[model samples]
Target: MSLRPVVDEHECALHGDCAEVAPQVFRIDDVAVVIGTGPDELIMAAAESCPSVAISVIDESTGEQVYP
Candidate 1:
């Protein structure tokens, strides 16, 4: 299964924790942005590390939310 990472701009705090966790997938600017995809583990780590809980992981095949 492929994982996609998404950042909620409204909830983002510019903490950059997600980028630090998965730089290849997420970038920090005014807010966290999804740049590209990485391994599922990396994506999940990034989402979990977000201090604001602004990052969410989705199952690309099922379109289901995988993480909070």
Candidate 2:
């Protein structure tokens, strides 16, 4: 299954950890951000690595996140 990256601009600190983990997926698009394709594990890592917890992941098939 595939996943999408939901970035919380408010909580994001632009730490670049997500970009580091998955450059192809996350990157610094100007002062803001941009993300690309990935899976749950990569998505989770990117989200968890965010010190501000600005990144969120939602499974496409299941249509669920790390929430209810």
For 1-68, candidate 1 gives per-residue lDDT tens digits of 89998888999999888888888888888888899989998899989999999988889999999888
Q: Write the per-residue lDDT of candidate 2 for residues 1-68, one digit (tens) a residue.
A: 77778887877777888888877788866433655686668777877788777887777788878621
lDDT of each: 0.89, 0.74
* Candidate 1 whole-model C-alpha lDDT, 0 to 1: 0.89
Question: Top model by TM-score, which number?
Answer: 1
Each prediction's RMSD to truth? 0.7, 2.2
Candidate 2: stretches off by over 4 Å: 30-32
- Each model's TM-score, in the order given? 0.95, 0.79
